[model samples]
Target: MKKSPIETVLGILVILVAVSFVHYAATKIDVRPQDGYTVSAVFLKSGGLESGADVRISGIKVGSVTGLKLTDDYAADITMTIRDNVKLPKDTTASVASDGLMGGKFLLLEPGRAKEKLNDGDKITKTKDFKSLEDMIGDVIFLATDSGDK
Candidate 1:
């Protein structure tokens, strides 16, 4: 027996919807890179930090931010997954920096000279937030006037 045309179209629609759902689920899941370890940092201000933001070392992409949260002390907590082979020293600093005047934000890692290496769950102590252009201009103007008075 041959199936009706309407029934055949309905079956196709159902299959298409199922496939679309699977695709959506796959994309929503966070698939971390294989050779990486997760680390976190607390910042006073994240300043446009979002999940999937690039984490860089010496202007080179090393990892991406995976998560962000607010701590009890009212600070922003950012979680990043860095490659395992890229060992960071104990005194390393993690700061929030921007790419350029109109570019996106990223995490900058500055390695220190400490002998010990950072382990998982270690928090980077030194952090710098994005400074607004207006603030910088204001500071420059203030400095110029103040220096002239002196």
Candidate 2:
């Protein structure tokens, strides 16, 4: 059988749309790894944190989580690449935080007041592990019940 002109035009239109999408993805949404300095932080819990997750400081993405591993001591050791321009202090705090109530997790960095700066591959000793929603709810419930009992 032979295809109609309408079918041929429809097929061409679909191909054009696919090409446009590919071009947009390649140019606008960069999937390539960014070049930056690498630092690590160890957490007691990952809470579903993954590689390629955003590393944010003051709600802005300053870097990305490049690697995640379970250390021998059973901690979540996360290696991240931060922008060279964003220098972190030696006492910077790193935490596993969720974007929102039901959003993905990211590595949140809180730069400290130290005059010295963190060097390449330096481990952030001050870290907070991920706290899930359930944990927070349980804490609140415990406090509420304990207050009533008193």
Worst 10 residues of 1 by lDDT: 28-37
Q: Which residue pairs show collisions in model 1?
A: none
Number of clashes recorded per candidate: 0, 0
Q: How does each model score on lDDT?
A: 0.86, 0.92
C-alpha TM-scores of all predictions: 0.73, 0.87
Model 2's lDDT to the true fold? Answer: 0.92
How does candidate 1 score on lDDT?
0.86
71-124: candidate 2 lDDT, tens digit per residue: 999888899999999999999999999979889999999999999999889999
Best candidate according to TM-score: 2
- Per-residue lDDT of 67-143 in model 1, one digit per residue for the tens? 99999998999999888889888888888888788999899999999999888878887777667677789999988
Q: How displaced is residue 83 in candidate 1, in Å?
A: 0.3
